[model samples]
Target: MSTPELHWFKSSFSSSSEPGDCVEVARTPAMIHVRDSKTPGTSHVTVASATWESFLAYVTE
Candidate 1:
């Protein structure tokens, strides 16, 4: 099977004023993908949607 293409985007909080210092994110139905804008080729992390949501809630709280 082949993986579907993902559309990655920088965080809204990420300003053009800072170069290569932001997080990029992409998503699928079941997983959230996260990577560093500075090193897109190095490595990345994938987490469950629920885990990602919980993380966001905790951080925002």
Candidate 2:
């Protein structure tokens, strides 16, 4: 099946001074997509929504 188009956005925590050094994220109903902002055309990593949420909670704590 074809992958659906994703709407990506740079993380707010990313350093604005270094535009090329930012991380981008896209969300779906059950998945979260991540990629380097500088290399948007390259491959991205996908994880379950729950896993992404757990990761965020861990890192933020």
Candidate 3:
């Protein structure tokens, strides 16, 4: 499938200079898109907005 058109946000904590790991994210009306920031041109995964928010909240807790 073609990549969806949406606004993506790169984490401030991400190191764009050099990296073994990095994450990129985007938001849709009902979902969140995430993928390796280092290889954004590759693949991305989508999750429900509520699940995404819950995961973030849990991680921050």
Candidate 4:
């Protein structure tokens, strides 16, 4: 599949004032995109909006 037009933002959970390993997050109308900041263009994962929310809720619980 073609890559979606996603504008990724670094997660608020990240606390690195320096450049190193990090995770990025982006959201579309229907889904969320997640990727590594160091390897922005090549490594990533995606999930449906509902699934992403569920995952976050679980993590924060």
Candidate 5:
């Protein structure tokens, strides 16, 4: 699917001082889509929702 078709949003933890430097994410029922805010639509990584949750838990800890 195209990036535009997805509703992308910047992470709340993203640095507001540098507007261009951030991570954007989109979501589906079973997948989490991630991409660089600077290079939208060019490439992205898709991961299972469970995996994304795990990653978040790891990092937040």
Candidate 6:
């Protein structure tokens, strides 16, 4: 199967003062994709939608 199109974007909360310290994210119905902003095309991590939500909840807490 072909890969789905991803709309990658960096977080507004990122600390831009530090180079390469930001992360980018992309979302699909089934998964949430994350990668380092500095090297986005080189590597990424994908997580289940539910797991991504849980991680956000924990991080925001």
Which of the numbered candidates is closest to the native, going by highest TM-score? 2
Clashing pairs in 5: none
Estimated TM-score for each candidate: 0.86, 0.88, 0.72, 0.79, 0.86, 0.83
Better of 4 and 5 by lDDT: 5
- Stretches off by above 4 angstroms in model 2 are none
| Cα lDDT tens digits for candidate 5, 1-61 | 6644688899776889987999999998889999999999698999999999999999889
Question: After superposing candidate 6, which stretches have Cα over 4 Å from the reference?
Answer: none
lDDT of 5 at 7: 88
Instruction: Count steric clashes of candidate 6.
Output: 0
Candidate 4 per-residue C-alpha lDDT over 1-61 given as tens digits, one digit per residue, 9 for 90 to 100 = 8866788888976768766767899999888889888888696787999999998899889
TM-score of 2: 0.88
Preferred candidate (lDDT higher): 1 or 3: 1
Clash pairs for candidate 1: none
Please say which candidate is ahead in TM-score: 2 or 4.
2
Per candidate, the number of residue pairs that clash is 0, 0, 0, 0, 0, 0
Q: lDDT tens digits, residues 4-60, model 6?
A: 889988876688799779988999999999988878669799999999889888998
| Structural RMSD, model 1 | 1.6
- What TM-score does prediction 3 earn? 0.72
Each model's Cα RMSD: 1.6, 1.2, 3.3, 2.3, 2.6, 1.5
Residues 33-61, candidate 2: write the lDDT tens digits. Answer: 99999889999999999999998999789
lDDT of 6: 0.87
Give the Å error, residue 49, model 6: 0.8
The model with the greatest lDDT is 2
> Model 3, range 1-61, lDDT digits (tens) per residue?
8866878788655776776566778887899889886687888898999998898889778
As a TM-score, model 6 comes out at 0.83
Worst 10 residues of 4 by lDDT: 13-22
- For model 1 the TM-score comes to 0.86
- The runs of at least 3 residues in candidate 4 whose Cα sits more than 4 Å from the true structure, single-residue gaps closed, are 1-4
Clashing pairs in 3: none
Between candidates 1 and 3, the TM-score winner: 1
